[model samples]
Target: MTLDVSEADHQRVSEAIAVAETGTAGEIIAITAQTSDSYHDVGLHYAVAVLFFYLGTVAAWPPLLDWTWALLMGWSAPPSERAMLTLLLGVALAKFLFVLFVMKWMPLRLALTPGATKTRRVRRRAIMLFKAAAERRTEGRTGVLIYLSMGEHRAEIVGDAAITAVTTPETWGEAMAALIADVKDGRPADGIVAAIALIGEVLAHHFPRDAADRNEIPDKLIEL
Candidate 1:
């Protein structure tokens, strides 16, 4: 998958994160993923559906069965059960392969994937990234990760333990909403900047910067 965020956009978001961090001890990290998961299970589902439909059509239409039998028998030999089963299996395999091929396109694959499954995968990926890149990196455990998965059309905000202790998850709703809106409009950089500003406001309220506070994490947009 191609990245929607460009280098210039990355720089813009990096600047926004820097500006936001200037007023608070909180560390904000923005990340965008082309996709959280391949959703191969969805492709498998389509293949299964195709197999069942092909089999069902053959079973329901006696004329189709007769045609297949004649084709297999060369119009001279009597139709045998073995020949019919072979033809059915071969056709089913071919149809399943065709379905799989069609689902290779990203749009078709995403469309076939369930919304709930996408959401779950996106959230799980966000949490994993927060742990790997943001959590425990801050001196005061005031790190927050803003993650967006483009293919799934999902966004999540994950805060470190210290930040979550003082701020509820609901507090990030506005930032998340703003980010999602901009992302949907194909302005991922704008979304990140907006989300950073909102998150900065919240962090400033709860973890205002001190004279001795130091920047602990890099303020750059990470693309995956």
Candidate 2:
């Protein structure tokens, strides 16, 4: 799955960034991703849960195995202990595999992931991307990153050392709120633009532009 940010949307975000940086030496970078992690472990956990549930149900009801055995083998004679155990294992494996197959669909897999897990993964990914793309890259160490994960409907804002030294995470609360509100309304570009403007206001207050200030980062929205 991919974010539906069109070329026009990209241009809008780029312009927002350019305008935002005009008053501050700080560099602002924006990134959007379809998802942060595959959460394959979540899928494995689900498959195991289903497998155990099936086993528990069959254990509590032995006749279920008898009926299944009869339906499969069509035999009047009761199956041996070995046959019953084999049938149980086989059906449990089938159930597990069926669940695994269904979870291969990305939407279902993402939907099944816990909200806390999604939040953590998106934050972690945003941090990693910030470190690689924006952290300490500017002369004043005033770079900032705004990351959004479409699949999880989550966002994170990370600031470089200089910015963080003078401002707390709460400093970006209004910008974050603006971003989430517009994103939830299916206006990602608008959300980003609003966020950039708000962030610019904060940065300008703390790190006003100097006569020699330069654009340390490209003004664009990176799609990942």
Candidate 3:
């Protein structure tokens, strides 16, 4: 959604404004697209956790029965012999391994990459410019990731496939929806600047020119 900009709201975002970026100098789009894509994995993990709870507890009868038997068995072991250590370990391991796809590795798969969001030159421009503006970078061979930002709140994702111009309300909405969908589908923020430019074009027709933009030059892309 476009940044809400009532006078009071502007003041709030001006204060709360937070920008996030990732990837490397040459891999900004890859980083943003990846970051956008990560939300899905987070959601997937959330779902799997629910399923594990249900399957491990309610769906199976054997564990409950085993536990009941253990309780009935006389002096199975000293009460002190049992502890939550195993349960704690299992939870920690699960969190470290599965359900943390981004945590592990999902490589910066850029839209510029085949089968990426959109590979058209225009799309690539949007992705590149957006990342460049934000100064994204990939740290190294390791899967380590970072987000860098200056004074930005709204994010846009643009591509050649994106509408040529944000000339109308419907087009504006489409642009907004696309970025949100990218996040839903786990895309990146590389092209977001182009998308915002497109929106600015739309606003130009109806609203007064946006007050002077406050966004500053992004820091140089680095291994972050």
Q: Which structure among the candidates has the greatest TM-score?
A: 2
TM-score of 1: 0.91
Candidate 1 per-residue lDDT, tens place, 1-224, comes to 35477789988998999999889999999889989998887998899998999899988885786786677666766667787788888888989999998998888899778899999999999999999999999889999999999877789999999998988879999998998898788887888899999999999999999999998988899998
Candidate 1 — which pairs collide? none
Query: Where does candidate 3 stray beyond 4 Å?
Result: 1-34, 37-60, 64-97, 101-103, 107-167, 172-224
Error of 1 at 68 (Å): 4.1
- Least well predicted 10-residue stretch by lDDT in candidate 1: 70-79
Give the per-residue lDDT digits (tens) of candidate 3, residues 1-224: 11222344323222222222111111122122222332244445554665476446533553543453356565465323243334334444555445445333334222112333322433444355544543323222111112211111123433221123323335556655544544443332422433334444443343332344323323222211
TM-score of each: 0.91, 0.95, 0.25
Worst 10 residues of 3 by lDDT: 141-150
Residue-wise C-alpha lDDT for candidate 2, range 4-49, written one tens digit per residue: 8999999999999999999998999999998999999999999999
| Candidate lDDT (C-alpha), each | 0.88, 0.93, 0.34
